[model samples]
Target: RYWPRFPRPKTVLTVKEVPTVDAAFVLQSVAGLAAKAALRGGNRDMVWYPIGHPAYLRWHEEMLRQTRANEQVLPDVWAVVEHFRRAGIVKGYVLFRKDAGDRRLHQRGAYDPSANVATVLAARLGAVMVSEDIEHEARARGLQRLADARGLTEEQCYEHWAAQCSDSVLALVDPRVPHCRAEAIALDAFVLATHGPLLERALARIRPDSPILGWGAGDEFQLTEPVSRWALWQSATNWCLNLPVLSTEQVGSTFPASSIRARQRSLWDLTWEDGVHYTSFLMTDGDNVQWLMGDFQFGAQRSWWNSPVRGKFPMGWGACLADLAQLCPYALRNLIRTASPRDDRVLMGGGYYYPDLFGKSRNSLEPLRLHARRIRGYLRLTGTSLLHMNAAKWDSPEAIRAYTVFAEEIPELQAILMVQYAPYTAGKGRVLWVRRRDGTELPVISARFAIWAHSPFPDDGPPAEIAAKLNAEPRLAEPATSDAENRSQPAEVPGFSWVTVHCWSWFKNAPDDAAAGAEETDQATAAASGAKRGLEPVAWCVRRLDPHVRVVTPTELALLMNLRLRPEQTLRRAVAELHLRLRTAQPARRSAARGFLDKAREALVKRNYRQAFLAGKNAARVLGVMP
Candidate 1:
C-alpha cells in the first residue's frame, strides 16, 4: 500500500532524470519464474496481472465509468479469473506508482498507513492490496525521516479514490512493503509477481537475453560475516521461487536462533515511538533464524544467502527457477519433516535437479556437504554446528589416532569420514566416498560415522529413506551451521598446495563409552596435556574445487551452470589432462613412463581444452581412445 501523498511520475520512459531501471531485465525476471512455475506439474494455479500499459488503464476506466460497464468487462476478466478460481487460486494485482516511497525503512516521516486506500483498491479491483503501511519502520528508531526521499507520503495520491478500503477477490501489494508479497507468495501455490520491488530485485542480476526460472544456491549469503547489498536480491528470488510462506503456527516453536545472522544483529523494529509498532521485525522468528529463511522453500537448494563465498561471487538472476520447478515435492517438503533444510539456509527445499548427480568430496576436515546446484561444498560438521565441543579435541590422543588414520586410509578407501561424537546429536555414521575417473574425490561429504550426540538432532542427515529402499544408497547431511563452528584454516592443506579450509574444534569428540571413563572424563587433566599433544593450531588440508569437471574458477563454473552444462559436460571439459604409460621390463631393460598436459595459461585467459586434450594424448604410447 503506497502512501497516497507522493506525487506521480509522467512515465517510466520519461523518468530518465532518475536512474532508468532495467525494465526489460525486470520483466524478464518475473516472466522467467512465472513460466517455469506455471509449467511445473502441481495441483496449483497461477494468476498474472499486466499493468503499466495504457490498455489496462483504459480497461479499468471503462469498467469503473459505468455500473453496467463492469458487467461487460467482467465476462473477459472473469474468464481469466474464473479459470484460476476454478483451479482454486486466489490472486491479486500490484501497480507501479512511477513514484513510490524510496525512503528506506526506518526513517522519520509522515504517517503513511494508507490502509483505507489498500482496502478500497481491493474492493474495486476485487483483490486484497498489500498496504505499504509497514515500510515506515526498519533497522532502527527515528525512522521514516527520509519519507520524501523515495516519494512516499501519507496517502497514495497517484490513484483515484485513494482512501477506500475493501477485501475483495484479489490481493494488492507493493514489494517495498517488506512482508506484503511474503504473505502472497508464501501461500503454497503457483504465482506470477510483477511490477513490484519483488520482481525488480529478482531480475536485478539477470541478463535480458536468456534466463531460466527457479535455480539454486547454497547459504553463502547468510554465513558470510557482513551482508552484501546484493544479498537483498535473495529476498526477491526467494519470493519468486519458493513455495508459500510458512505460518508461525506450523513451526510450533520460535524461529531458531540459528536463523539470526551476525550481519543482522543491529536490525530492529522501525517504530518512531512507543505503542506505534505498526510493522514488526520479530528478528528472532522463533529461535532467531533469519526471517525469509524460516522454513521457506525458494530455490533448488538452501538460499545462497546462508552459505560461504567461493572463488568468485555467484549471480542472482542466474538462479534456475525452471530446475526448482521440476524437482521432487519432497525437496520442498524436506524443510519441515526432515532434518535442517540447510540449502545455504536463506532459502530451503529442492532435490538434486539431475538424475545422475555423482556425490560429494569433503576436504577431510569437516563433514557437512554444502551444495549449490550440481556443485557441493563443506559440511557444517564443525564445533559451532554442534553447539558443543571446545577448542581442544584436535590433540587428544583419540583425535590424533582418528584423523591421521582418516587422512591416510579414508581417501585410500574412497570414504568420507564423519565423526560420531559431536555434542549436537547421537549416532555413528559410515558413507563411502565417491571418486571421479580422474581419481579426485567428490566433495559431497557426510558425518554419519560419529556416534556420541545425546539427542535426536541429526548427526547424519535423515537416513536415506527413499534411496536405500529403491537402490543401495547414500545421502549426505545438511546441518544448520553456526558462525562459531567456522574454524580457521591452517597455512597449508596437506596434499593440494592451493586447497585449504578452516578446521574447527568440533572435528572429533569423546566416544560415548569413553565419556564416562575415568581417564578421558578428567577435563582438568586433559586440557593441559591436550595442548601439548599438538592440537593448538589445528591442522587442516582443504580444497575449494570448482564443482565442474574441469573448470578451476567459479566464473567458469557459473557460466557452465548457466549454459546448463550436464553430465556430458565432462566430454567437452577444458582442463589440463595428463597422460602417462609404463611397462615392466626384464631386469636388464629399463622402463619409463612419459607424460604430457596442457601448456600453462597466459595473462587472464583460461586454458584451451581442444588444444590441451590432443596435446596430452600425443604423449601416450597407447594412443587409442579408452572410450
Candidate 2:
C-alpha cells in the first residue's frame, strides 16, 4: 500500500496574502522545500497552506474543516520564513533573480539560470530560495529579522553557498534549440546532465525500491518555456528526480477511492441499446502536482472540481496517483473525499511518467515493464482500472503494440484512453486490440474528437461548430449494420464518439451568445476569468447536441463498445461467472441459468448483440452473479 501515514498537523500555517505572481512562485517553492525538510527532520508538526488570492481563502478554510485541522495565520511571505526559522528547520537563505538577463535566452522564453542555481544551493545548505527582487518588498512588508540566523546579506549568503557547490557538475541547456529541453528533461532522472547531482542526491535519500519521483513542470511553465517555473530544478534540489516536464499538466494526479472500490462496474451497465449517438466527455491534464496544488484547485483558474456545472454531466478526470501519494497525500485524500459520484470519474494519466519516453534506453522493453509494475501497484492503490495514455510514436502497428506490455503487467486494467497532440496523424477513429497469454483482449481506444484551446486541428473548432459536425456525422447518428462495417469505419464503434476536452478550454457565455459571433470572446473571457471559468463549453456542446445522442462516462463508453465488438467474449465472462455462482444455487436456478446461457450463445452466433447482452444479464441475475 502506498497509503502513507500523513502528518497530523497541530498547527496549519496559512499564507493569506502574496504580493505578486513572482512572490507567490517563490513562496510556494520555499513552502515545498520547508515541508520536505521539516518532515525529514522528524517534525511532522505543521502543514503549509498558501492562498495567493483572497477569494480562495474559503477553499483553504474548507480544506482545514475537512481535515479537522486548525490554522495559525502567517500574514506574509516573510512571516512564513520566520516560522520555519523558529522551528529550527531552516538555517539560512539563498537569493536569485527571476530574470537571468541575456545568459538564458530562448526563442520561446528565457530560462532563469539564477533560479536553477539558487535551488541547488538552497538544498545543499538548509535554506529557502527567495527571489532577490522581492527583498525590498519583503522588508517593506515588515521584515524585522534581516539575513536569517547566519547574519549574512542575500548576496553574501548566495556567494557562500555557491562557493561550496562550485565543483558540482551542471548540464547547461540552450532552450532556443529545438528538442534540447526535451532531451535534458528525459535524461534528468537517470543521468547527471542539467542538475544531475541533485537528482542523484535525492535518489540516495529515498529507499532503493521506492517509486521514482516524476516531479513534472510547474504551474507557470509550458513545453517550450522551461524557465518560468524551474519546477524540475526545485524538485531535484529537494531530492526528487524530475520526469519529462513536457505535457506535465496534460497528465493527471490522484485517483479517487470510489473508482477503485467500484472497479467491478458491470460491463452490461451501459448497453448498445442505450442510444443511437453515444459520447463520453473526458477532461485532460490532471498530472501536474503543482497545478493541482496551485491554480487548478485554488487560484483564478479553479473551474474544474468546483464548477457549478459539475455533477450535471458525466466527465472523466485524468490524474497521476503515484506522484500525489508521494508529494502530498492530504490533497489526494481531499480529492477522493470530495469527488462527486454523479460527475467526477478518475482515470490514470501518463502512468507515473509520460510512457512515450520513460526509460533511459529507447530500444528496450525492460524499462517499460519495470514502469508497468510500478503503475500496476498505483492502480491497485488508487482503485482505478482505466488509463489515459499518450505516446510519441502512435501511428504504426508496432507503436500501438508496445502498450500490450502495460496490459500484460496490469491485469486489472480495463482499457486505455489514447490521446496525441495531433490526432489526425495517427489515423482517425483508431482502436487497436492485443490478446494476452490467457486469450483476454485489451483495447486502446483512440480519441476521435478533441477540444483544446491551442489545438491546431480544424476539428477542434468552436463548441457550436464541433457539435454541429457531430450531429451531421452519419456514422454517429446511425447504428452499424454489421460488426465488420463498425470495425472498418473511421468512427470506430458505431454511435459512439470518444471526445477529449483539454481542461484549459471552457466557454464564458451562454449557448446563444457563443453561437452568434462570440467564439473569439469566449477564449478571451476564459483567459480573463482564470479559476472562475467552469465547464460552460461542455454544457454548451451538450445543449446543441442532437436528441439521439446520449452522454456517458469513460467506463460506460468502453464497456458498451467492448460488448458491441466482442459479444462472444462478453457472454463468456458472464456465463463463466454464472456457472461458478450456480454451484451453490438451487436446482431451479441452475436450470434457469442454463436456459439463459444457451440463448446468449445462440444470439452471439446470430450477431444479435442486444439479445445476447440481455440473456447474459438474465443468467447473471438467476445465478446471483449480479443484483
Compare the candidates by lDDT and give the number of the best one.
2
Q: Write the per-residue lDDT of candidate 1 for residues 1-627, one digit (tens) a residue.
A: 000111111111111111122232122222222222343433222222233333223322322332121112222222433343344332343222322455443232222334322323332332323223322221121211211212332224223332231111112222233222322222211122222333333222322211111211223222110111111111222223212211111111222323221111000101012111010000001111122222222212222222222212211111112122222112222322322221111111111111011111111222112112111110111001101011112224433333333233323221121222232112111112234444443221112211111223332111111111111111111221223221222111111110111111122222223322111123244333541111111110011112211211212222222112121222123222222222332222212113232231221134343333343334232332221
Residues 1-627, candidate 2: write the lDDT tens digits: 221223435556656666674555445444544444533555543434343443235445544554455677777766777777677655656565664345433223334345444444455554555566666654564433223312232234334543443221222322111111111222221211232234334333322223322232222122211211121111121211111111112112322344333334676455556446777777766655545544555554447766667778777776655555544444455566666665545554432233444332234556556556766766777667788765545555544555777778887766787776355225344678867556888777877776555456655645665566566544543655443421223455567667777676655454454443354345655575642233657777778877777778887777776676666776677557666777788999989988988898888789776787888888877876656
**Runs off by more than 4 Å, candidate 1:** 1-45, 48-79, 86-369, 372-374, 377-627
Alpha-carbon runs more than 4 Å astray in model 2:
1-38, 47-49, 52-88, 98-108, 130-264, 293-302, 325-346, 350-354, 360-362, 423-426, 453-456, 475-492, 506-522, 525-534, 582-609, 622-627
RMSD of each: 23.7, 8.3
lDDT of 1 at 581: 21
Give the whole-model CA lDDT for all candidates, comma-separated: 0.22, 0.52
lDDT of model 1 at position 161: 34
What value of lDDT does candidate 2 attain over all alpha carbons? 0.52
